[model samples]
Target chain A: MSNRYEARFSAVGGQGVLLAGDILGLAAQKFEGRYSLQSPTYTAQVRGGPTKIDVIIDDEPVMYPKTTAINFFLSLAQGSYDAFLYDLRDDAIVVIDPVLVTKWDEKYKTYQVPVIEITKTKVGKMIMSSVLSLGIMIELTQVVSKEAIEKALLQKAPKGTEELNLKALRTGYEEAQKLLAQET
Target chain B: MSSASSEKSDIVFWQGNEVVARAAIAAGCRFYGGYPITPSSEIAAVMAELLPEVGGTFIQMEDEIAAMGTVIGASLVGKKSLTATSGPGFSLKLEHLGYACIAEVPCVIVNVMRGGPSTGLPTAPAQADVMQAKWGTHGDHPTIALAPAFHREIYLDTIKAFNISEKYRVPVIILIDEVLGHMSEGMIIPDPSEYEIIDRVKPSVPPEEYNPYDTQYGDVPPMANYFEGYRFHVTGLNHGANGFPTTVPDICHNDEVRMIQKVMKDVDTLTEYDEYMLEDAEVAVFAFGSTARGAKMAVEKARQEGLKVGLFRAITLWPFPEKVIHELGQRVKAFVVPEMNLGQMILEVERSVHKEMPIVGVNKVGGVPVPPYEILEKIKEVLQHA
Candidate 1:
């Protein structure tokens, strides 16, 4: 309910990470029921390199679209985890793609998710891991409704890939449900 | 839209550049002259199309210099006219624009900024024009500028630009930028009962009693137009009140000093900004245009995580809003500036903050918004040190 929260997403190009961050920002607006302003800042590497996206959500008026110290860190690449080890909050909850980040430091206890392999093996190669990882992000926050996140995903994904992304999203969501049950 | 209206209306959603054109139309503007540039080209295009619709004439001048001259000439005949351009065009226009200021002609100038120094980035947004908008014109003359931070602010501020120009009988700049101009979103247009339109204060006394540059009341004088049944001399070479060319040394000094004093005395009313969270905070972000939107987000996210961050968005970027900035700088340990340019606004932030305090900048150039995490990193750094 506070007016500020900084969420950072890190990954490489083609990871659909930008799309995931954008959807969460949009969902935050819909969650507020006004024209919620979503200001995102990202890096400019065209090919393969560490790319980070920041999404800020608040109930009050937004003055600028940038922030620091991500409360939520979603790392879809090994580079993302390595990059964000120092960038996150002291107790920041990190969701990592276990396939990419095979190793983890003891200083930070992270949620290791086989996001890429599960997405590629079950959802097929044409789909991206970001869609699946978004399911975990939404499930974890519970701040935005699944429907709201889905609409944001539908609006953002490329022209022909929306359906597969949605399917991959559902598969990921079901996977998270199993994890939630196991933890409980 | 059948009949013409010289009426100012309430706030509404409109493109930043287009709002300048509408302001010109609402102020009884009868002439428009401009050379096109990105960000600001929309203003000229809108004027070219709509000016004729309102029974006014629109001219695309040869260059910024000619564009400025044409508007000045048009205004001399009692016409409210305007011109719109970007960084380079504005650079070409300042000399004549300065002439308009010294001559006390009523005209609106809109500069929709792109990145700069030279050509720079045509599509990128930058507020590098703030200081220039005030002092780019040569010599000491009163210049009024209004910067709109959103599409909605654009409409209201552009109308304010016209009113300020007409009320004082001088040139005013509708300083807008590329982000507000090109960004698109929709809103319901307002009905007519919302605005108070103003026109120049015309002289009601006899022609013989008039002094064009008289400082009797010391604000700005209302004299007859060149041929409005009264004769008045207009010159760029520093003239006398009797409508004749004057080279007298004291007269020149008085004329220059009077022009600047008029605006300087009323700078308080001209300055504008909107405060958020600064009423209770230890760190704040100062931003404008596209970068401001990003800063707003970062602040919100930081607060959710229990970090103390505030936002200060400048709706009117010119005149520098230094007082508000200085106040916040005194309370907050540091003021973070996030801008699209490499470091244009950071210089202003640094200038105002003035202490060994941490003044950070999250810059994004190459045509993209500054990412939220870049801001997050700075916030965390600030938090850790604190």
Candidate 2:
């Protein structure tokens, strides 16, 4: 695999998509000793508008921070999924919330993960869905190791929510592993 | 395990705006006065949180005008002061910026550019303010503006801005577009000894003998802080060596010329640029700020395609590196200027090269960045015509 990998996280403004990108970047740069960059689409509204963050993780220095092609794409909302689904590599791994995203291209490899449902039912917080999605993204891309993800996530987790966030991340990882086994 | 209290790591993923504030603190900037605006608010926010921790002060003033005024006021009283804003707020600060220019107060202003004629695109990135930065404050006053592309450069250049401002006793502006301001990246925090820190030269004479605008001490007179027992007049009008307003023809002429000459005479020392693979290249791409990041990639891609193209990325935007551009004009066959504006710095390039070679621009003002492929296509198109 090439040293450089670009991942995009998309959702509504209040959905914590940017925070997820930040955690992944922290994991790569601080824990994994890799270089990472993140650029987010800023919206005027505080909530309910489409927002996305393009993250690049590389073994070498990242010259151009903006992503031209995506290696891994995750979308938690239908509008963001539709708006940002264009520039994906041929073998790009696409992850989506099945309930939120109803449409997809059949030719592309797609994973339908119920991120919001999992966060609400298993992790006990709707906002934890972003962290949950980061787990799935890590399992698929391996951009940063699980240990690094835990260290970075716990560092960023809100007061008293470390165990809840870790539970959400571990649950997402296990679900993705089951999907990988089924694919084989 | 609470995020509210976490161990401090040596290196953290920081936004460009955040890094600017951290660097300002590291550079001994003790006062921040700013009116928060989109794409530049993070600088003010980070300063508000960190400045107090370091015994520095952060104040959110009533408006952009007051913000600039407070920064100038603070700087006059011996505090290394700073203020940040976007397009509209930058316009408001210009009047006071000129005041600081004439009064010879040392301060730093950061303009994190957003798309604008007036609040055109608050959250979108644009580089249209290139000319506005150089000529925004009115008159023919000298300007020193630094444009940094990445997070690390933002940190380094922000400190450099303070150094240049203190050393010259002139206001320095750091230009960052919305993309560079908001982008988050990894940057290693440098040790204090790794970079040179320059504070303004204090007046060596006694209080009675001190002159704020003394010309005998060469172009840059040793500055006296307001409360440092030296009382001197300060005004926006043309002033003499005593810092009082002057209407005398010779005194006015000499003072104005010196104000401009102090920076102009040192243009060679002030000019900082990146020349990538230009030694044997026939074409050069002139870019700055975030646009140069893509321009560098385009140069690499063109080199792989057997094209002789190089990138001249300007770190110092103002005092326009004319000498180097003139020298490069003699060697290169064509110039490709790509900017986020309709066309601003391209005019400077034309003036510097004196139209000696074919010059073209890949201009964009739609709040979208000019991608690498588009820049590469422009380079090829320019070469075909050349």
What total of clashing residue pairs does each candidate reach?
29, 0
| lDDT (tens digit, per residue) of candidate 2 on B295-373 | 9889988999999999999999998999899899999999999999998999999999996578889988888788889
Candidate 2 lands at a TM-score of 0.96
Model 1, which residues run further than 4 Å from truth? Answer: A1-184, B1-14, B190-192, B345-356
Per-prediction DockQ comes to 0.09, 0.45
Winning candidate number (DockQ): 2
User: What are the per-residue Cα lDDT tens digits for candidate 2 across A46-91?
Assistant: 6998889999987766767688778999998899988888778999
Q: Deviation in angstroms for A131 in model 2? A: 1.0
Interface RMSD of 2: 8.5
Query: Distance from true position, residue B180, model 2, in Å?
Result: 0.9
Error (Å) of candidate 2 at residue B115 is 0.5
Residue by residue across A1-184, what tens digits does model 1's lDDT show?
3445666777886676766766676655543332323332223354587876666655543444344455677887787667756646777767887778777765654677788778878899644677788787777666567876787677667899888989888877877777778789
